[model samples]
Target chain A: MENQVTRVVFYVSDGTAITAEAIGHAVLSQYPVSLTQHILPFVETVERAREIRTRIDEIYARSGRRPLVFYSIVAAEVREQIVASQGFCQDILAALVSPLQEELGVPPQSTLRRTHGLTKHNFERYDARIAAIDYTLAHDDGMSLRQLDQAEAILLGVSRCGKTPTSLYLAMQFGIRAVNYPFIADDMDVLALPPGLRPHHDKLFGLTIDPERLAVIREERRSGSLYASLRQCRLEITEVEALYRRHGIPHLNTTNHSVEEISTKVIEMLGLERRMF
Target chain B: MENQVTRVVFYVSDGTAITAEAIGHAVLSQYPVSLTQHILPFVETVERAREIRTRIDEIYARSGRRPLVFYSIVAAEVREQIVASQGFCQDILAALVSPLQEELGVPPQSTLRRTHGLTKHNFERYDARIAAIDYTLAHDDGMSLRQLDQAEAILLGVSRCGKTPTSLYLAMQFGIRAVNYPFIADDMDVLALPPGLRPHHDKLFGLTIDPERLAVIREERRSGSLYASLRQCRLEITEVEALYRRHGIPHLNTTNHSVEEISTKVIEMLGLERRMF
Candidate 1:
């Protein structure tokens, strides 16, 4: 809100909004809580499309400063529509993906990753492989923890910092073995990693989000319960973070970040080898 | 390849393998495909836990005596590693998803719905507003489209039989606002769903799949290109089901399906009735 001047990075893709979301999500990471954010929908229809322009002007007029508008797509009409707005700056989405344009792109890549007819077969092999691994792991009698030894990373977080999906994401994208351990009361509250898990500290990566956000997530899973209570969420988060602090564990707060951002941070933190596009 | 075994159904929590892949894949789903399939992962696990063991055991050996394993948290070491030889199984990894249980069955209730703390001035305003709208449609922009207006039931068919992901399966699960579209062409051909795609029918659903299994998808994408060459995949899949025939539209094949699945399918197809949950 400083200078009544807003600097916002909008990710506009000439392709599907999915790409836009990824890029937008990535960009959000570059800035912490300091930046104000607004993500408007796919700019379709002249009316729905024109709203951004007016809003920018309104913001500009109200603040007496130019508004920063990041345009995510490459549609000429969409671009034109966005540009017509007075005092609004337009930033192209794709270009912002990376300095190495060709490197960070998917095909049908130019327009969008044409995701039509993605056969179940293609999905099966990869998915089944993952599920198969999941199956084998699920079936493994804990007599052996050796399989997880080679894991590139392990995620530690209270019950819902999105560790499972993030772990699977790491496995899927980087082909790295990732394991997540939930912070249940028996363990998280006691400020002690489960005895079975304490040995893996060297590979552990912690994920923490705003307790408020955690409460929101819990509410979605089970509303109106002590489990989902914000009061409970705050207490747990504070307890966990304090334990993490005492244990010298480095953690990332996932509030206001996408899974990609969180994963990227984990990869960066773990110094994992980059994933092939 | 086993004696008297023509088909196999694997119930997985992720659902990627059994439904997206096993339903109609190459290495897994082929002429050998037989039997009515049920890949309900935790449903059986929960049922089994609730003394539904007979039901689960029956399902496992249901492939006319060959046995179909309904694996889940049933076998996780988290629960002291229940042991059952020659019956349904489980392991640790798959147990991760058990936390999501209360959200699905018995009428869509999300565990994340009730927690408070997000009531910070900004959080509550936005959260409450979005909570009032359709969760599916409100959570994200509902950015991708498959003829929302004319869509009867969107078919979310990835290549091969990802159709189950988009059509029958989704419809059966959520109940409304379904649409599906297919992606064709491979890494080369520049054709995806035609321009001005006001699907002659109602809302449009989409299907995509894993790329590794999309030899036919490669064919559809490039039609005889080196990548799509049956010689490459060494299978008659391409000739067996042309792209349009399988997915019901000329689409832009996206071999790797990730974001599109979560946002597009979750929002457009399922159309979660309310946002709070």
Candidate 2:
């Protein structure tokens, strides 16, 4: 606080504040300013807004800088109360509501917690995601070979190539039925696909990593192990890439990719539709 | 497509297009119109944007309804090309950029794919998330009681009270080290906390569900068992509530709550900060 000029930022919302935080983080990432953020959720009442306003004022008094407030409060009076505080208050819901009202030819509902609702009508969507999650957890690491047929995409990669996390993310986030099979020592020796995966060639997506990076990742888990050796990593990666090329399996280098990036690339390459939003 | 006027909607971006899709879905949920969605990710080049433009025109020509394009494309020319497409184009990045630039008194770096980059410096963040995921998975269902000390939060609930998914979601989405411990028959008989969880009572959050709903959920897993009986469910839920009250553990009824809602509420109640955005 002494050397760096830190500004207080609040993601204020009447609901979970996910939308506010999403828009706030995206907006704030552009700025080259150090920020300390507070999530003030369930600020539904004017009194609560005023309390937050007073807190912001206190911060402003100490720092001699106006705090930045990003809010998605649906209530007009409550939003106004927060705006009255000493800060640049950006109302995400207000910006969205007007544009949406005009576009939809109707005024927006000023209700709280419109997002993340699971009603009876939307139960199937919830159930589908749960089913996908169950399927992913059950079939992880080629555990259930028979269930491979039901997978939207079967991810094949060496250990620590990020198959498990990516598979779970694909299932949980998008409700995509993803099953991952790790290319172990036995499987990597032969240049042929495993018997279980041979039938699902069209649904297979390969994840490859730099041998150096793979070695480093594995070394973190089990140092001095044969599997974590750079030489072993190089051999396995080379063999896996050759197999991918030989089989015409679409693959992506995941050495520098996040799970989001890997999942997106797999979805794009395979053109897998997201089962749920 | 016939009864409901179907409009083609594209969530377009140079990177994952996740932000575009999230905001698009939130905005479009207000409208009652049925939508046909296409995720045209990695639309980095003007050529790719133009190709998407052609596809939008084709859809518009066939459906006689202008397509909706929600984009987070950072490149000006690429975004312009998408805007020229036959649709009502909404630029999420543009809406965010100008306001943020004005507030911060600095123009944002119009760099493509800024969100999901995995550089050396950012590896710690990724590693933290992976570690949390591993911790959550290992400590799930009290599989390893010795590892309970490592967990940031311990979720205690009756069987099928939405513990596993919530824990996984928290770990994956927020990088929170969450472990769920279910109250089995032996543990529930005595009005005392498990010996393993006694020291970590402060970290425990209880989840209760409607007896009828709990019975239904248990029935789906294993039908006609004593565990799935309504009377048993009522007894268990009653005892769980009494335990929560006696132990002063914060609890939430997850009868009608989605995982998102339940997780959000738990975080709010416990004042748990998300390790990642």
Candidate 3:
């Protein structure tokens, strides 16, 4: 039982459960616990809630410990049923909605799935996101230096050092037009900004990571290659950081950071305004 | 003044300010107030905090109304300065940290920017996300059908029907391997799933949208093409919905939904398990 120490956790929501999962992940990460997650998304009906409660109770009975549930269900009856469950429940939306309603002086519409729905005014934001995604995909890996002028930021990084995912994350999350340019071996040795990136130098932000981390990431892609060697990673990273300093282009090490962290930090460092909601 | 009604809003943080912006966005969306935002990120020093306080006070003096500030500063002294300002403050991180500490029975690590950092356990999730992103990019728009066996979900939709962005969002946010296949004009007319998608029928989820909305979206991309015409959009949507029913495939209309909503709906409809945190 000690070796099989797994706490059953559920992220239950009437809608997508994304909000529940986001807040739950943030909160749960602060604690050092081994969790097994059961995401019961779209738990809109009383029957669904009842079924989820039963599953949670079963887990609790087996483990001899209360299950942890983070929920964002909006329907009153459905919420009540979950409340009656044996598991310890954290009501994510309910906890915020009252304070928000009081602050805003307007009752919520309480419409199902309203949080992630697009309003008339926000359609432009959607369009901007789509545009950013397209821009990011097209301009990925120095694909089109001609459109460097259109990019809000050009990410320069050694291969496998967290550029592509961060670019796509920035594009999708904040509608920031991000383009990533990989620093290849030839480019790294010279320690010069790529000829294509020179005119748009202000938009350049470098991403580097610990060489050991880079080696691990690259080895997963292509094992036994010199490209995945720690020495190669160290040389590339050192040169790229030097290149960034020489060009006065600010940079961050992506060693311990997630894509979300990298994207937000990049935005902060560059003083880039989010193009849309 | 009625037409010029605007509230000054600030998202203040010692790190990226993403959490402040996220909670603030959710809270402020419930109100009808039009906001002019001033994001102050990486406000670490007391001097910077005082400067921000002065700025907030100046905004209050000009508008004759207190500005709204959503802050996630972890440091006590810096948070105090923001609290001392004229702005009406909502302490987002403070609201959660205390509750979380009490619930988890441990004081917070209080480390700046730890919320989005990577842990050793989560590195596998990061690898999964990179794999997903690569898989998505390769299989985008029916580009490759050889690996349909590998996809967690296959999106079927008409052209310009919110497939690409939704796929990218799922991959980045949830590490879900999503591949989107666009239904071409010929395929829509035939009212059939593309041959490439036939083998993966169980994995298919359809995206449809209002014809007028589709027309508006398409018009932005290709102004005078037949594909952008309202008649063409209506024809494609009607046929696609019919095709979804004929195959008993679940579908969602993305007309009023954001990418987040669509991705979640798709995941729910298919009962897809998120591959990572």
Candidate 4:
């Protein structure tokens, strides 16, 4: 920790500050500097802004280096306080907004716009997202097969192979109704698509993982059990991969991917319309 | 849609394109223009990049205006194809990265860095996230109070008051072990903290909603029923709010907030350390 150059960075916003944090992380990832990060969200009031400004200034005084502040604040008074601090303040949204405003020839709306807030304009979409989540929860782990028609995608995988998280991400992030079913040890003897899932084959997506990784994940849940054995994991994966290939089901190896990547790839492979929340 | 200035915007990337789309949406929200938006993810191949470039060029030729393109690609060859198109291209991360490079006195690494990818460096953190999700799912809706010691926060709310989604978001986005318990009509007669939850009073947070909104949301699930009645909603909310006040539990009205906003506020209110995934 003492070896590299450490920089203090803050992501500040009047709203959730998710956008600022995301952009800041992406920008910082490019450089080799280590970061001591803080996120200050919902900085709407002037008092809070002044406190944050003081914090930024104090960090500068203590470190003898200017802190980097990436912020998206709508109010001028609050934003000015952060700008007045002894830090390099970068407006996360302003750089792109100015060009877009010029292109559209429309003055930017000065109203406090909540990028991640619920408004009347997006209430329906928001409701749909909730519905997707509900549908997903009800159908998780093959809980129900009655509503297969409503599912945008059905994920098939062994336990802990990234099906549940990917399904939930698809529903939560993109408002897509996702169903995930697990292929347990009992199914290894006769590895075939369940009769109930046969009709929805087009929506089926498989997730397989490296046996070594799967064994490690399972061992965490049930330590020193046969279920967590490497031999079992390898056997299950071999059978599952053979089943997928025989059925011509498009699948992904989830050994090295995150839930975000798996969900995005699932949506792309299935040609599902990506709904932005 | 025709009355307003309509612009075609593309968020192109070699990865999930989530960051690009997020930044693009935040920037474009300030303007009053209608958008025909497209997200092109995983444009890793030159062939795919060329196709996207042709698509952007065709849109420009048809509209007689340069389409707006916000992209983040690590590959020079693929990025050049998008840049060569007749669109107002904006490098989403480059604008900030260049300045940070000068600040840190470190040259940026030219390797392909996947912002949302799982790697050995983050595998333990990633495992913790999955464990959080598993804990949350097991403890959702008062499924079990056996592991209250492991919970970072316990959400208390009336039915349909936005506890479940908020809890899931906290677990998924911040890797917080959140447990949500719903107050049902059966418990309204003697409204008090459950015996199991009394030990974790410090971890308890309340979520309330407007009666009208609760009724509307409930009606979507069960139309023309007592469960969806406005009177029932009002009674439940009144009792829940009184209970929250009696217990000195901090609460928020989730009537006008999105899941993201509510989750962020919960973490802020509880002073929980925000973990970035």
Best by TM-score: 4
Ranking by TM-score: 4, 2, 3, 1
TM-score for candidate 4, please give it.
0.98
- Give all TM-scores, in the order shown: 0.39, 0.94, 0.87, 0.98
Name the runs in model 2 displaced over 4 angstroms. A1-5, B1-6
- Residue range B82-154, candidate 4, lDDT tens digits: 9999999999988788777777788898988887888878889999999999999999999999989999999
**Residue range A1-277, candidate 4, lDDT tens digits:** 4678989999999999888998898888887778899999999989999999999999999889899999999999999999999998899878788777677888998987788989868778999999999999999999988879999999999999999888999999999999999999999999989999999899999999999999999999999988999999999999999999999999999988999899999999999999887
For candidate 1, the per-residue lDDT at B272 reads 40
Error of 4 at B243 (Å): 0.8
> Which consecutive 10 residues in model 4 chain A have the weakest lDDT in total?
A94-103
Full-model lDDT, candidate 1: 0.44
- Identify the CAPRI category of the predicted complex in candidate 4: high
Tens digit of per-residue lDDT, candidate 1, span A1-277: 3533234433333323443343333323222213344545446556655777777777667766555455554355767767787644435323222222232122222332232223344554445434322422232222235556666677777876767545654654444567776677555446776666677777778888787888877888789988889888888888878877877777988775444446656776776753311
At residue A60, candidate 1 shows an lDDT of 66
lDDT of 4: 0.92
DockQ each candidate and list the results. 0.03, 0.53, 0.42, 0.80
**What TM-score does chain B get in every candidate?**
0.28, 0.93, 0.88, 0.98
- Candidate 4 Cα deviation (angstroms), residue B143: 0.6
Residue lDDT tens for model 2, B107-141: 67655435765777788788889888888888888
- lDDT score for residue B58 of model 3: 95
Over A1-277, each residue of candidate 2 has an lDDT whose tens digit, in order, gives: 2554477898888766766777777767666678898987778899999999999999889988888888776688998989898987887645544565555455544454356666666766787887888889888888887767688989998998999889988998889999888889777666578776888888999999999988988898999999999999999999999999999999999978888888889998998886544
lDDT of 4 at B148: 97
Query: Could you tell me how far off, in angstroms, the CA of residue A61 lies in candidate 4 after the best superposition?
Result: 0.9
